[model samples]
Target: MSATEQPVHDHSTAALDHGRRGSLGQIVSWCLWDFGSNAYNTVILSFVFSVYVTTAAAPDEQTGQQVFANMQTVAGIIVALLAPVIGVWADRVRRRRLMLSVSTLLVVASVSMCWFVLPYETHHGLKYLYLGAGLIALANMMQQVAEIFYNSMLVDISTPSNVGRISGAAWGLGYLGGVITLAATLALFVLDGGFLGVPEQDAMNYRAIAVFCAGWLLVMSVPVMIWGPPAPPAKGDARTLNVVSAYAQVFRHLRRKFRTSPQVLGFLVASAVYRDGLSAVFAFAGVIAATSYGMDTTEIIIFGLAANFAAALGAWVFGLVDDRVGPRFVILASLATMVVFGGLILAISATAMFWIGGLGISSLVGPVQSASRTLLTRVIEPGEENEMFGLYNTVGRAASWIAPGLIGIFTALLGTRLGLLGIVLTLLGGLILFWFVRIEGVTHNRSRVTSAA
Candidate 1:
């Protein structure tokens, strides 16, 4: 084993065991942020706005694809750069809710503005495309910052023993929210041929969905602010800080982690690769359903609902197993399942094959993600969870370009099927790297929750 791969003795897990379980209402309130924030995933990135941009906003099909790629790459870089700073700032503050509220409102405002993209045939479509790109891109960056605080809050809500279950519950509920929103979108607009008799001006159906997404996010985000716990101050002097030194602090903190427990760094790197692949899976699902699977807008939305439902079920079910078998085993199995099903979908050109394999592929998504959070919660020291989760986002975003770049390049040079190959390779590569990294500070003496799912 590599030096970094050796397991650190699990000293911190016990201290985490002492925190109150808190009421189930409180836990659900914390998870409600994830449920609400998923409007970005379902509506903008994966389903509505992305498709609108590439299909209607750009000058033509080819240009639209290129523009979409460039937008994502640029947005990913901005989010990556800002994520650590936000994490550090969040760590310094007494309440993560302050940052969370600002970021959430930005997302809400951005999606609301997307109600204007006209059809590509219109004279104003190109102008709207540029406008949509800027607004959506800004929202995307803010969403990443919001999640850094959202995830860091996990430390405040639960004890170590049930962290996996809580993580999975939040992830599952988020996907459930995705299924509900996608279904509602389909019912209200796409299936009914536009609700409220709104005249079709510039892709009015797609435009209306943007307004709906903003409303959905706004309603769901309020509960977390009202009900979640207050975080203690991070014990740092933030008044004197600037951007460059903020990153330097991150580096120094990571250095300390490396000296004390190299596996933390090792796991961070391993998880980053797979999370990129997972992001691609969500971001491109609707595009693939429409383009490659021969699905109409309504068909695509139905597929989205089914896929997200499967993901929610998988996440909740896997959480039960995670507490028993250990998160290491769960992640290994989840990644392997994704690779198999992702390949299966690419090999078969039929829509039926795509439907079966697409849902299969999605089912694994939540478990790996939820378990990654759980493992990190198991590892990080007391009072530093926010910073560690921030490092998690920073490292994850560092390689964020990998999946999208590979998808863009391979789809151009080879075919769309080859783009699927890029996602597969990311999962495979992460699984390989993760093989060497052990789950930190997993304690066996603690009782495993038998009733978690």
Candidate 2:
């Protein structure tokens, strides 16, 4: 292969696939992991635990926002520092699943501990504030790291003919899980006084939900461990390396990619910019609804359900289209839709905006995210999959602070509603760069070659 071209490496052998077509049970198991993992996404970050930490636990509104942003900033920094190194290590050791399992266990443990983050009037310390936010931060980092490993498994269960559908199915499962889990939260916690008559005092209602979210993740996340494609030994060249060597290897890998496969570099940078924006959109969705759109807790929960449903449907439908028309189109279209919807939401300030524009914006979120993953898989080879996915998470998290950081800065200067413009800007950046990307090697020939082989 020439520089700027990807070599066709056999992906069939890695990440639980054992070089065979994956079974339905295995596919479902893999997707279910997304389902379970999203418990952390929906409950802790987007809606319940974070809302509790910021609004209920913090001293004031501004401090709450600052604290939430800072917590994520620190977590992003930690993830950025560790993701590539750990990914390098996992690839070397051929222990991606072990790494994922341990990371997931940490998420469960940390989320459950959020139960103790009782409100201020009931308990008198910044201890809960720090503790809750800290756990949320840790969980955020751990979950992200886990996803790097999880994402590597995509090739294990996919074929070029069906990769889009497989990825879309998994993405759909994630949103569907959020839909079901969030609805369960509404049924179990938000509607009633919550389990065991947990007093609304001290934010106990939210505290109980934290415990529930942990349990939810625990149950949803375990199936993949049991049923995912059996991980084979890492590629023959996969050698164990120390941390220093691991990073060295990563540097060499990046150097090779930048020179020989500039497309990879371009995709990485573009993905980093837009994915940060995508993360921010979901991260602050509930808050925006509550504050800007005047969505009550009940309404926010309902909106989350509607948004998840829309996202799940969009991902599934667009995924099939992704296979035929290509992920590039899907991504561009999704970004364009998001830019338009996000701008409209910024300009308009009413419940109608959230209901229409908010849902429209949420619909685009999944296709962009799912297509992004699918696009990356279409670009890279096998042995380096784990490392690349790690870099994916690394670069993404490296800039993770950007959207939230910009939002924090702008919100402080202007106002909450205006701060949302940051997301639009980041998306625009990614969309612009994405336009130049040319998928030369993998997308056109890999499927035919793999089928022939």
Candidate 3:
């Protein structure tokens, strides 16, 4: 198990053998986690619940935004603090399934709380909102950590040659899952108006969606728990570190790895900026449509479905490009596309070209972002995949505070449309920085295999 010794799983062989084994099924199940988790993102965090809390529950839009922002800030801080430690623990214990189960359950419980969010019950709204926000944050953090382990399992399942395809498939499947779940929820609750006599606007309807998400997550996860191979325990003599010690080890590992390879560090920093911009796209899309374009709930849902569908398409199409050209090229291409479309969104906002331009931009944004993720997967080491992704989430969390905060600030000073310009700036800056990065080392690392299992 020494660094030089080829571990049981050789990177190249695993990558090649990925799909040959039960890789396809395992990868699909793994991606389903994203699908199920995004139910929360789509319904609760991004579109529906956010609007409900800010507009319906809070006294005013300003207060609602403040509350939401504060919750995110707290969540970001907590995630930033704990993620690396959890990652280290996962690597040490090689017990990803247990962690995934715990995290998913928390999400289900928290999301179900949405049932308590009655519009007339404004006094209780704040308390519930705060509680929900905390749960959401914790769930999100746990989900992210589980995702790292899930993705790391990819190396165990697939070979180097098909890693890009597997990664792309996982991502595409995730979007597909989101599309299906969202469509079902929308059809059941919003369009059909009542599941078993529960009105769409009633808390029960929303609760149904939460229940569906929770069930979906739990059910889909069973395959991985049952069929996916378990990671072997850390080698003999490897000491288990506590949370504080784990954090210290993470920082030390970061320094050692980054110092040995500056390119990885550069890629990480650049990816952080762009990833935040990518997140902002989904996070604020509904807000922009609602406030700026006068989009109602139905329109927002339509937009989300369309965007997710486009993302699925993008993942498939750009996946080929990622494998053929190289991850760096695909990443740059995606980022460039995002910048163009994001800028177009800002331009079309003040014109009669709202839906025309908006939909066009929306269409491209999904594929471009999906492509970027595929590219990121191409650029990192296999053994270090989870830790790298953990940092990816960390940098993303750190940058998370900026875009939303800036949007609010700019909106307060300028206008909503103008406020969105910050998003464009972030994307463009990330794209530019990416151009200067050297990817040769990463390419070499990805090509090498150190595992033997």
Candidate 4:
């Protein structure tokens, strides 16, 4: 342990009593939550439902895209405001499971409601578009809020020696789930009206997919709810904090952390910056492929599937490396490599080069994400896990506009391909910031305690 690192406390509550750190069942159950969550993250939010809302539900393509973007911006602001307060409440009452359950169910409900968003050709109104947008935005927000509790659980399920690989496995599972779900969607619904032969008259295929996503999430959520450890006993009463009080408490916590452990805050900010860059890389890679490489929609989808596979593979491999070495080393190496790959994609115009560079950057991204989560889990003090993760999400959403904004500016000034420089710059900036983040060592078997998952 580092000289400045404080001793971590162990919780002996029945809900947290884990034999052998955490059983394989417990760990696998935790990972399945990620797999199930891909229904929302991959299908509804990223690929299928969003595309339907923008292109079919709305009156026109431009209007649909604009309205959906605005709704997401609003959702992002609300999440930033609410995440910390919810985290604080969950920790105070020791009701992480209850909170997680409520949020997850809410997400399910929101996604299921997406079934009502009929295409304009069938419904002939703006209401459907607005309804679809609203439901998706709600689902997105609740999903993120659910993640606060979900991420806090990571500490409970793994030891310091294995947290890296566990986190990596979970992330890899999510990417794999996304790939499978997306491919299934294409094969079963979107391609040639699908083999199911669900009539295309009113866009029933997409609506059915929404219902499927809801069921997928609900069913997938059951394992963790049943087998996962319950929250530990509260330290005190469960008085809830209002918005003002919650923000005040969060600020006070940040101030104290800054004074006592500046690296905590440093990692939060640094990870937020680079994470945004990672998101942009995934978001814009399709755009580059279409515009620069002249890849058609079918080709783009195939590339996306391949990219997810690469990311999944990288997460699994680097996760083992993380356990042997440390998350800091994994994160630094991944981010540095990503910066170089992003530059290569920007500089090279060949189709083969785009495939190589795009997949290279994609592979690096999952490791960085997994390593970042692992590092945060290791660094936080014993009891403040939920609140710290809430801050992690908030800071991340707060800076969410950087990469997109930079991409917009650079694209306007230069061209489409050169706009990728913004992504490279954002990543380089994060790498520099992360270089200064010190991971205080902890005694693996002594002070580090089994927490939540």
Q: What's each prediction's TM-score?
A: 0.91, 0.91, 0.86, 0.91
lDDT tens digits by residue: candidate 1, 1-453: 797685446543633564556577768888888787787788777886787787787787777767766776788788777777776666665568877888899999988888866666776446766777777887888888888878877777777567778889999999998888887777777765755665557778778888988988988888777776666655556454578877898889988878877766888999999999998898778777766666887777778888899999999998877776668888999999899988887777777888888898899999999988888877767666667787888899898878877887878887876678888889998999998885334523224332331
Give candidate 2's whole-model lDDT: 0.80
User: For all the candidates, what are their Cα RMSDs to the real structure?
Assistant: 3.5, 3.2, 5.1, 4.3
In terms of lDDT, model 3 sits at 0.65
Off by over 4 Å in 1: 1-7, 11-15, 18-20, 236-240, 443-453
* Residue-level lDDT tens digits of model 4 in 1-453: 999877543322222223326678888988998988987877787656887888899889889978888898999999998889988877777888778888999999999999888998778888898899999999999999989999988888887668888999999998898788878878887788887777787898988889888998898888887787676666766677777887888889999887767767888999999999998887777767776678875687688888888998999999998877777788889999988887887777777888898889889888999988887877766667789899999999998999988988998899888888889999999999989876445213322333332
Better of 2 and 3 by lDDT: 2
Per lDDT, the best of the predicted structures is 4
* Tens-place lDDT digits, model 3, residues 61-142: 7777777777767777877777777777777766766766666666676666556655535354466556555555656666
List lDDT for all candidates, in order: 0.78, 0.80, 0.65, 0.82
Residue 275, model 2, lDDT: 91
**Candidate 2: residue 152 Cα off by (Å):** 0.5
